[model samples]
Target: MSYIPPHKRQLKDPVSPSPFPDSLATKVMKNTDFKSSSVKVNIAYSRDAIFKWFLIGSKGISDEVPPSIKLVPVSSDSSDSRYGEKSFVLMNTNVEKENVIAEESEEEERTRWMLIAEKVEKDLVVAYEQAKKGMQDHHLSDNAKLRLVARFGKILFRRIHAGPVTEYWQAKSSNRTFCTDVPTSFIQNIKSKAIPSHEFCIDLEKEVYVVQISHYTRPHSTIICKCTVKEDGSLSMYKAELNPLRHLVVDVSCIDKNLDMRFMLAGKRKMFTLTEKERSNIQRMLDSVTVDSTVKGGLTWPHGKPPSENGYTIFEVCHVRATTYKNKTLRLRVRETNGYSERFGTWEVERGVTLILQDINTKLQEQNIERGCVLEMLRDALGTIWDFLHCDASLT
Candidate 1:
């Protein structure tokens, strides 16, 4: 007698049969087109499930994308409890083909940016080490050290195409990075050059050509001041001691007009209108003063308020993958919301969603999601919605 599987036995007892009907199962078996390897079926996953699975899948797979699974909202009747009006789903199917292609292109772009950033970081690190070695070995002056740093910063700024970064020393020491245009080294270099000397020639008759100091009060105010340089080298502008030359930062440049020499002072305050008939003279004068001070030194250079830094490393795998996944999910939802974009405008919806996304990002950041805690926090933030309709064993 041929052995028969227990499931195929004809004995009818108090047995828990599979949910799928025999006929459907038979059809599924017979259908040649329903190849399991290529056929993709849509299935809904709870937010918690998605977070868990994504984390696991990402870690497990090497250069392999997660299997295509469509995530829909958990049905209202599926569970006893319900939560928010907005349920997040991970639906990759609803996105248009063109949009998918665009996402792929974006992925490529991210990869390129990451590669470039990595190279920049390595180059900067080498440069920084070399500068430190030079300072240690050659006993380079503080000014020379700063100049080396400035040169390094210039390379970074030119290549990154982003805002200035804070000092590499600070960034490296703190084990953190920022995204800003102003390199700390560049600022330090300027400060090193602009050390102020309080010694002012006490000649009250010295004529110091001044620029209009009231541009804020009057736009296009080209009013020039013919003033006597005070004993303290400050110009008396309505009793306000405007230190135009001796105590100013090295950010002077000719702006707006050929005659207008715009320069920011040590404290980031501006006072403008020293000029000559030839614009070249004004440029040369600015350059000369800055060079003289930088070379000869002056009083302690005041620090400018630091530029804000909020940039992150682009090469972190965890960050990039998380960002990519979030973007994909966001795109899918955004497209769903704009289904009425053709018939009715999506202005209102788009505005509302922008706020929502901002809030979500804030929350995500608050979680302090490192690689270890990322999946856990994500799962918690996105509560579970149990799917009960289709059991794997019953389907089989």
Candidate 2:
């Protein structure tokens, strides 16, 4: 073999045939063609598979979008148009559903509030009716009435303590005394000044002098006297009589600020005395009275003209034994009308008295009497021994 330099070795052409045996070369060409065809078939199959997969993925994306969004066509001019339409439809659908649900909830809430309001109104009406009924049926209790009787006694004591002034003049001489030393002018004046009555002065032309007298303690009783007045100015009594409707008798005494009063209603045949319990109750009520500057003696009814619905006045002082009291002793026997027609039960009197006390205490809470000063004064004036007789004069 001829030796050649390494840099001068000849390069073979790419298109030249192989320098191998024909049979081996043919086998090589066959293997090369088979490999080339296999590669081309694989590439064509991969491209078609990828295109089908892309189409399927696109269809899946369209299915995921809501039908309302899918109906909106994609605009070629604006890339964001399709996305904007889809979002608007989705948002609108969600918002509409939320609005409907909210409206239903709001309607339910309004109905609930109305029901609550109606219930409250009904309760208020019922409560108001009950309160009205209670007020209408209200009445005083037995204890209250007893207190009222005590209050009445205290009022009488007050009047007696203040010196009960009488309205009529008592006859100093005999019941049928005659005036013989009367002047003719005096006779004429007396006849003119005197009120003529059918019973006393039947003939006014006659020179007659008549005097009618009524006592405060015995208002229903009258003393009438008729006298013949001569022109010579002499008055002579011709007739005299006592007209009485009913008799009144009373006995009262005071000792150390305590009153022992007894009364006898002759016409009614009822005799009663103030028990120790009654006196103590009266004292308590008197002490509870408040002092009022507008009233005389700092003690008076806080509410004027106490309610008489119960058929009796609480603090009414009708008769006072003023003239009978002498040297701390009083005795009285007179005729008067029976003002109290109906009999009072113990309960009624107590209820009335309690009501009066409540009214006074409600307005002012202050003690009026100190150590029974007013009562003591009354006791000192009325004396330890007293007697009174009177008719039923309870103001109904």
Predicted model with the maximum TM-score: 1
Tens-digit lDDT string for candidate 2 (314-376): 222111111110111221111111111011111010100000112211211123323234323
lDDT of 2 at 29: 33
* Candidate 1 lDDT score at position 215: 27
TM-score of each: 0.16, 0.14
Q: By summed lDDT, which 10 consecutive residues of candidate 1 come out lowest?
A: 313-322
lDDT string for model 1 (1-396, tens) is 332221221211010011111222233223312112121111211111100001011112112222342223324332101111211122223335334434454334323322222212322233334434444464532323121100000000011122122121112111111111122232232223311121112122222322222223333222232333335443332212222111111110111001101111111112223323323332222222211112111111113111111210001000000011122112100110111111111111110000011222233323233433433322321211000000111221
Off by over 4 Å in 1: 1-107, 144-396
